[model samples]
Target: MHVNARFWDRLAPRYARMQVRDPDAYERKLAMTRAFLGPEAQVFEFGCGTGTTALKHAPHAGHVTAIDCAPAMIGIARQKAAEAGIGNVEFRVGDLADMPDSPGAYDMVMAHNVLHLLPDRSGALARVRRMLKPGGVFVSSTACAAGAPRLFRWVAKAGHALGLLPLFNLLTADGLRAEIAAAGFEIVEDWRPEGGRAPVLFLIARKPA
Candidate 1:
């Protein structure tokens, strides 16, 4: 995901205007995530595009710190937060690597639809692990490019090659689980919702107590 910010900056406006393709599936993910949150929770989210999920989760947590690499994305996110009068979530223009090296800082860390897009997936997961308090949870929903149809995979790669898409890793759901485990997080919930155009791997993992 570390590339020129212009790519995402160009997409920010249209991304904000787009509607959720599956409201039911989206609500299910939201509910599942909310179950892990509490009023005393301190939450951190990386690769937060437009701050939608962060804003939604704010009511359940004490504070939400969300970051994205693209300035345009953060700009739009800040606007959304102000318009919605949501004051608990702080949206910033930064990458995961820019996050402070503060171990055990957050009660929960989330990365939704972001893992497969990272060029350094293992490094990012390790960072997430370090940022969470012991026994705290990491929740993620990743697009499993390895599980996509052959034609889609080919097209995605071609698009990346032509600079039409961002960096993407063809990581399988099993491989993602293995990586999270290797990062010293215990997988507690592994789920895949049905009837999606592509496979999404939803997981809740906890740092060792």
Candidate 2:
């Protein structure tokens, strides 16, 4: 995770400037996520790049704690929050592993466009499960690239080897769902947006009450 921090730190500025690739899809995700939020909801978001989603959800949730390993990203996120006058979201520079355990601390936990980057997906899922209250929701949208063409996978691997990309787990959509279930989550919503170049799975799972 430390090694990946440097990669994200360097990319933070450019990443913040780049527009969302698919605005409609992004909006749909926000809408889906908002449906689970209430005025009293306490939320935790991991890999919260630039805190855009956190800020958006802050008004709907009572509070949001969002974290990323990259200091630069968190710095930008804090700046955005300040600019937006959004006080409910707390942006921090640390991954889940660095955070102190607070069992059942959050009503909802989100990991958007991030799960596939982790070296230990299952381990991270376990931690998320432990952090959420019973009946809490776990939301994630992950790119499942194992179905990509062999040549594309080879190029991606080569890019990572050359330090052009962060560590990416070649996960399949079904495989991700299975892992979530194995971690004691009962999936309630599973949807894929239409007409995407790559397969991205958007899921909402609940920790059994």
Best by lDDT: 2
Model 1 lDDT tens row, 108-153: 9999988988888889988989899998999999998786778988
> In candidate 2, what are the lDDT values of residues 1-209, reduced to their tens digit?
56689889999999999988788988998998999899999999999999998998999999999999999999999999999999999999988987999899999999999999988888899999999999999999999999899988998788788887788889998999999999999999999988988899999999998
Clashes of each: 0, 0
Deviation in angstroms for 147 in model 2?
A: 1.5
lDDT, candidates in the order shown: 0.90, 0.93
- Native RMSD of candidate 2 (Å): 1.3
lDDT of 2: 0.93
RMSD of each: 1.5, 1.3
